[model samples]
Target: MNAREVNTLNIVGGRVIDPTTDADGRLVDIHVVDGRIAVIVEAGGALPSADSVLDASNAVVSPGFVDLHTHLREPGREESETIETGSRAAALGGFTAVVAMPNTDPAQDSRAVVEFVREQGRRAGLCEVVPSGCITVGRAGEQLVPYAELMKSGVTLFTDDGNGVQDPLLMRRAFEYSSDLGVTMAQHCEVSRLTAGAVMHEGSCCSHLGLPGWPSIAEELMVHRDIELVRITGGRLHVLHVSTARSVEMIRAAKADGLSVTAEVTPHHFTLDDESLRSFDPVFKVNPPLRTMADIEALKAGLRDGTIDAIATDHAPHADHLKEQPLDTAPPGMLGLETAFALSVGELGMDLRSVLACLSWNPARIAGIADRHGRPVAVGEPANLAVLDPGVGWTVDRRRLASKSRNTPYEGRSVTGRVRHTVLNGRAVVIDQVAQR
Candidate 1:
C-alpha cells in the first residue's frame, strides 16, 4: 500500500493458517510495525502495545490474495473501470495485490504504459497493482513485444488476453526466449478462427436457443497445443481460464510428464454452468464460455487434486450499456474481483485451507510476487494479509459494490464467506468490510 507512515497495528484472536510456516488453524496474535511483521504471539498470551488493535475473532488471518487476472480498464477505457476503483474493489475483496491485464487503449506493450498503470495504482493507495505486459506488441499477434525491455518495468507475466497467439511457430519462438528471461507466457487459449461470431458454449443450450455456440474444442485445442509446445521448448506456459474437462485432464498429464506448465480456472467456470444462459442474459456471457456440469465437476476435481494452480478472478468490468446488449452482441465478461473467493468457497466443497490455497498462496506464486505479496503471517514478513470469516453469509448489492461497473451475475444471490479486513504493508486498507481509503 502507498500509506507511507504505518502505525503499530495489532490483529488478535485470529486462527492463523499460514501455509508458508506450516501453520494450520493456530490461534495467534500478529503485530505489524513499520510495514513489517514485528511479533507474533499465541492467542490469550499477548502483551503488545499498539496504536490500533483489530479484533479478528472467529476469522482466518492469512496472506493477502493475489489475482493472476484482473482488468482495471485504465489508460483508455475509463468509462468501464479505473485503476483507483478497481484497486478499491480488490482491497474490499481481501486482495493485497492484483496483476493488472494489458488489454488497454495503447496496450501495456512498452515500459512507459505499464509504468503508468503501476503509478496509478500507487496513487490510489489501496492494493499493489502489478501490470502485465502484452505478449505481442499492441496485443496484436503479428510481432512479439520486447520481453526483456518490459521486464525492467517489473512485469513478469505476459499475455495477449483478448485473443490467443494464432501462429504456432511464433509461439514456439516466444517460449524459447521466455525461460532465459525468467518470465511466464500466459495464453488466452482461444483460436479466433474457431470462435468467429460465437456466443455461448456450443451445446444443447445453444441448440434450443438457436444462438451461435462457442465450442469447447476452441479452448481445449490451444491447451493441448501449448502443452506440446512447452514439452518441446522447455519454457513456462500458463493456460488462462481453463474451462473444459479434456483441458483439465491434459494439464494434469502435462504436469505428470514434468512440463513447466500451470493453469488457472475462473470462479464463473466452476460455479456457474452453461445452463445459466437459459435466461438469455448477457451477464452470464463470458470469454471461454461456461461449460457443462461435467466440466464444472472436473474443474473442482482439479482444484482439490492440486491440478489447477490458481483461482483467478478474470475480473472484467464493462460499461452498463455494453452488458445490456443482446447476448450475441454483448461483451463476454462479468465483474469477478469482489465475489471470487466466496463463490469458490461455496461451490468447491473443499476445506477452508484448500480454498485458501487456490485464493491466496497459489496465485501469489504464479504472479511471481511471492517475495512480497503471498507471505506467511510470521515475524519479519511483509504485513499483507486477508482476514476472512468463513461462516458469514452475504448477498451482492450493485450499488454497494466498490467497482465502477455493475455486471456481476450474482446481484442478489446469497454467497458464503466474507473478508473482515485487509492489511496491506502494515496498513489496514479495509477494516470490518469497509475500504479505509
Candidate 2:
C-alpha cells in the first residue's frame, strides 16, 4: 500500500451493492486508500494489510447517498440549523453530499452567498454541501437572479424552493437562462393563487379538521405549467417533493414527450397521509401537504417503475418553538436527513440495489456529483461509501439527533435499516454506527 493509505482503514466482508454497473449485491471485500477504492476482492479473498479493518459481515455496503434537496438553514437561521450540525445528521443518514437550499438569510441568489455556503460546508468537512442558487433574486419571483455568475460559483442547480416563480413569463425566461448556463431548475410546484391561505390537502381530512385547504390542483397546475415550460425552453426541470397523483401523471406524460424533466418524492408523502394531522400536531404539517391513500400508492408505483428519478430528502428543519406554534401558523417543515434511508428501505420494499440507485446514484447524477460519488465499488473510484445493517430495527429518537432542530414526525417510530458506517474521501467519518469526529 502507498504511504497515504498504508495505515488507513479497510472495509471487508460486506454485500456490496453498486447500481452503476448493474451489479446486484454480492459478497465482496473493498479496500480504500488515499481517498479512493484500492481493491474490491471477492469474499474469502486474501486479506490486505491496513491500519484498521472493519468487519462488515452480513451488512450491506453501497455508495454514499446524495440528496438533491436539503434545507440546512445556515448563515441566516443558525437557530434552526447550521452546516456542521446538518452535515452530522446527513452522515448518520448515509449521505455524503447534500444540496443546500438557498432560502437562507439574504437568500442564495448572488455569487457571494453561494460561495459562503460552500465555504461553510468545507469548513465543517462532514459532508459535501452543494448550494443551490435561487432562480429569482430574494425569491420574490419578480426578477431572475444572475444565473451565470451563480453557476460560476459552482452551483449546479437553481430554485426558489419555498415559493415557485409565480410569473409564467419569468419562469419561461428562467428556463431559457438555465438551459444556457447548464444548471437545473427545481420547482416547488405550487400555485400561490390557488394555495393561498391553505393549510393542508383539500380533502376529507382538511374538511373534517375545519382547516384551510391546499388543493391538489394548486400543485398540479403549476406542475403542468413547468412541464410545458420545459418543453418550450428545452431546459432541465426537476419537480421537487411531488405529492399528488395527478402531478405524477403530468410528469409521466412530460417524460413520454421527451422533456428533460425529473421528479422526487419525500418519505412522509408516501408513508404518512394528511390524517396524521388529525391530532393537530404541527410536526406533520408540511408545505406540499400529504395526500390520499390512492395518491400514496401512485407515488410508490412511480418510484418502482422508474417514473420518478430520485428519492431526495427535502430535509427541512424547523426550530422547536416554531414547530410548536398552531398548525396553521407554524412553518411547514420536518427533520429528514437522519431518517430518510431507513424510511426508504422499509417503505419501498425493493431490492438493496434498486433502493441505493434511487438514494445514491440517481440523485448524484442529478446534482452533478456523480463523477466523484455514486461510482461502482471498483478499484480507482473515490472511497465515498456507506455500510448499512438492514436487519437491525430501531426506534427514532428525536433527542439524539445531531441537527439543531428536532421536528421529526417519525419520532419513536420503528425503522428497519440503520447506517453502520460511512467513509468519505478515505476518512472514516462514521464507524460502528457512530459519528467519528
Against the hidden reference, what TM-scores do the models get? 0.98, 0.97
C-alpha RMSD of candidate 2? 1.8
Alpha-carbon lDDT, every model: 0.91, 0.88
What residue pairs are clashing in model 2?
none
Give the runs in model 2 whose Cα sits over 4 Å from its true position.
1-7, 21-23
- In candidate 2, what are the lDDT values of residues 402-430, reduced to their tens digit? 88999999999999899989888878788
